[model samples]
Target: MINKIVAIQGNHPSKLNSETDTSVFLAHEIQSKNYKIFYYDPKDLSVINSKVIASGFFIKFNYKDKKFFKILKKQKLNLTKCKFILIRQDPPFNLEYISATYILDTIKDKVKILNNPTSIRNVSEKLYSARYQKFMPSTIFTQNISEIKNFFKIHKKVIIKPIHSYGGNDIHLLNKFNSKLINQFIKRHDHIMCQKFLPKISKGDKRVFLINGQVCGAISRVPKHGSFLSNMSKGAKPINVQLTKTEHKISKLIAKDLKKENIFFAGIDFIDQKLNGDINVTSPTGLKTLYDLSGVNLAKIFWKELKA
Candidate 1:
């Protein structure tokens, strides 16, 4: 008999917020279909005697309970025996993350892995969007101090982001050129992304969900008072929104491209109808928030497209 198991490679459950977490939302959806969830951290994955084994526990998520998740049992699991595996970890995309993908690569053919292990490794979340730079704000990816200075001089106001960081952490908006700050930022984050700041960001940004290379649905995230970041992990408020004609065109083009790259699911952002330079393929989020804002459930769409 086929094991009715879906393994999730992610952080510990205590660190995950069930209300806004896409992993939890997805786990909940699949669990209702009678699939058992095997929860494990990427650090615990190992290739033992040519078998991909993961040290984790079976879990059940209860959205209605104050305590959201219940860990049933702790054991080592042979991942190849599972029907599907979901890489649901958040990113700093460090070496450990890359190594996990490499290990998963071994058994990818045997088990269905969402967003394909090899594809996620090959695609740098921010760098992959460089192909669509014409649709993005004036942006540059570098760690060179002189180059950053030149870009800042040209743009006047700029937004600086760590290339591998996620969830709006270590992102800064600079209105003035400060040599010390630039040096410090480069030292901390190696290569960084610098973009021309759009003042209209106060209005909000649109997050478009792409599933199976199709433009599934989208939601608007409005930054909290005085903040410029639109990540929901920050205080951004999510609301229902419609894509403009231009937004739809851009999204469709990107969705097709990502699908070609073997990415099963993704999320892209837009500001004032221009691409925001983030192609969130590593661990794309916002499904739960999107469902809460709009009755449209992309989780259902995600699984339906996968036929998992």
Candidate 2:
């Protein structure tokens, strides 16, 4: 039997936070299936002789161990040899990220790439939510100071965040719009997403996990004291919760679209039944937190769909 090899494109292990790291949890989950995990950074991939080649080491991780990761071997592999490739790197979605997508798009016919590289490149997590704005809160995509000011005028209280950002970084809750700061924000981020700030966010936001375009499980991420960002990485606490009727309806709608887009997995947020308009696609996290709080093993469901 040919050994199933799953190649993961991600950040170096040195930079990860093991406590709530989703990639590490996923790697460990699949390891039990007797599949070999090949780890590499997106920067380490190249096109050699019309083939996708990734230079990395095979690592085996387990919960019970003195040394957590045991390296089996190192090799330069043509991606065609890989049964599955997971593009799991966190993103700024910069030029380098786009270039990697272009490279990976080449071998997609032969190798199964999760969350399809071409699909991810086409979908800018925050911006892609624009298409379903009727289900979303008052939102706008602009870098101009005047436009943002106009949005704030209508929404009163607004949230301003960078289009290319994730993990709740650079997210700002503006009660009163400041033109100068808005100008500075636009200058820095190039394009920004401005939306009506939902007061219910103080309670929590629902993060729905979709695997193979199916809503598998979800968890509510309650913000820390006096804060509104519900990213687990941003110190939000996960809570066991069920999706409301409205949340389930919206998830179903988006799930169909995601499947059409070839997005194998995605994480989307909701506050007070209103779509937050941040569809976290590139390295969508919070799975470990979900499992910890809800006892719903989404990682198992994720691999089940992948294997199917």
Candidate 3:
């Protein structure tokens, strides 16, 4: 018999705000289905006596209200006791994140781990897109200053981002390359991704949500006035939109491959139908926003795919 317990490895309530969180939306959806929602932070994961365990709470939530949650109980659990584990933490994907994956991988034989710990570890959110270069904008991943300069010279306008960074943080849109700043950026991030800036972004980049290798819904997040970053967290506004044929094709390709990688869910972006080179596997968001804009609650589709 399958255990009905679902453990989510993520931040606590005090650190989350429902307005911008997908974890709460996802957890709430699962809890509403009568599954016990156990929560823990990646830091709370440990390997004790060869058993992977987590210390956290059994939570329940209702999204109908602004304050959307309640902790029904708190306890330490051998992760193997869980029927499923959702790795929902935001990324910088530091050492702690890597350690948590190692611990979770141990109990993966007993508990179904979403996105598959080994697959998640092997897939670099940005760098892994290298395989789909033909579908992407002109992008170079390197630490070499000269290579970046050469790429800038060819592309003219460029965006520089860290291979490991997320939430649109540390992303720079450059009309003209600055050697000093570029060098400093390279110094700060171990491996950097520099791509041709798509002026088409003025129209907005589309975030396509995929669940279990299928396109469930999508939304266009238009950048705030005079901004190049389209991240909703950066003040972008969501607009209901339909995917172009090419966008759907590219997204489906990535979706099928991610499924092959055992990635249960993911979100990818497109700027004028060109892959943005950031496969958001770490913690794919915008489900709530998509629901609000398109009235498609992929959060419901999410649990259905997992059969939670």
Looking at model 3, which ten-residue stretch has the lowest summed lDDT? 60-69
Candidate structures ordered by TM-score, highest first: 1, 3, 2
How much is the lDDT of residue 146 in candidate 1? Answer: 94
Q: Candidate 1 lDDT (Cα, whole model)?
A: 0.93
Give per-residue CA lDDT, model 3, range 1-308, as digits (tens): 76688888887876887876888888777777678888998888877888887889888877676667788888999888888898988889788878878877777888898878888899899999999999998998999988988898898889999888888999998888798998889889988999988998989999999889998778998999999999988989889999999999888988999998999989999999999988988788898888777678888998888876
Candidate 3 backbone collisions, by pair: none
Each model's C-alpha lDDT?
Answer: 0.93, 0.87, 0.87
Better of 1 and 3 by TM-score: 1
Reference-based lDDT, residue 167, model 2: 86
| Clash totals in order | 0, 0, 0
Provide the lowest-lDDT 10-residue window in model 1. 293-302
Question: Residues 68-187, candidate 2, lDDT per residue (tens digit)?
Answer: 677789989888888888888998889999999999999899888887989999988988999999999889999878888888888899999999977889999999978888888988
